[model samples]
Target: MKKLRKMFVLMGTVTLMVNFCSFNILAEDGIKQVSEVQTINPRSGNVYYKYKIINGKKYKRLWSADKNAWVDPYWTLA
Candidate 1:
């Protein structure tokens, strides 16, 4: 009976370890996917600063393709 109990405990520990390792691998894969999706396209037009009119004011700002958003703190005419 004692040997059977020990065997079960060993099996459970092994199962838990395997599950934890697999979960970590899956999480890493997900992180890689997210990073890849967020990467900016080199050929995209976001690299150059563009002119924008806001509140009757002309400002310049660069777009961030990686973040999929426009940069804040627009550059105003000097």
Candidate 2:
């Protein structure tokens, strides 16, 4: 009986650790998406744009313009 209890406790600890690690990974990806969205700017109409300075060349990427707000589609996945 004592050995069974110890085994149960060990299994519980391992399960908790696995859950925590998965949560951390998901949260990290969310943070990265938030940071990327901050650099975008939407213009008039339903069109949005974001310019990035890379190698001294400006690269523009399409974004979404909704009610004067620029939103990145990557972070909007449900």
Report the C-alpha lDDT of model 1 over 1-78, residue by residue, as the tens digit: 999999999999999999999999898876643334476656654455668787887878776766677775657652
Whole-model lDDT values for every prediction = 0.76, 0.69
Q: Across residues 24-71, which tens digit of lDDT does each residue of candidate 2 receive?
A: 999887664333436666455577667777666666655655555545
- Please tell me which predicted candidate would have the highest lDDT against the true structure: 1
lDDT of model 2, residue 61:
57
Model 1 gets an lDDT of 0.76
Error of 2 at 76 (Å): 55
Per-model TM values vs. the true structure: 0.40, 0.40
Using TM-score as the measure, the top candidate is 1
Q: Which residues of candidate 1, in runs, are more than 4 Å off? A: 32-78
For candidate 2, the per-residue lDDT at 66 reads 59
What is the C-alpha local distance difference test score of candidate 2? 0.69
Clashes of each: 0, 0
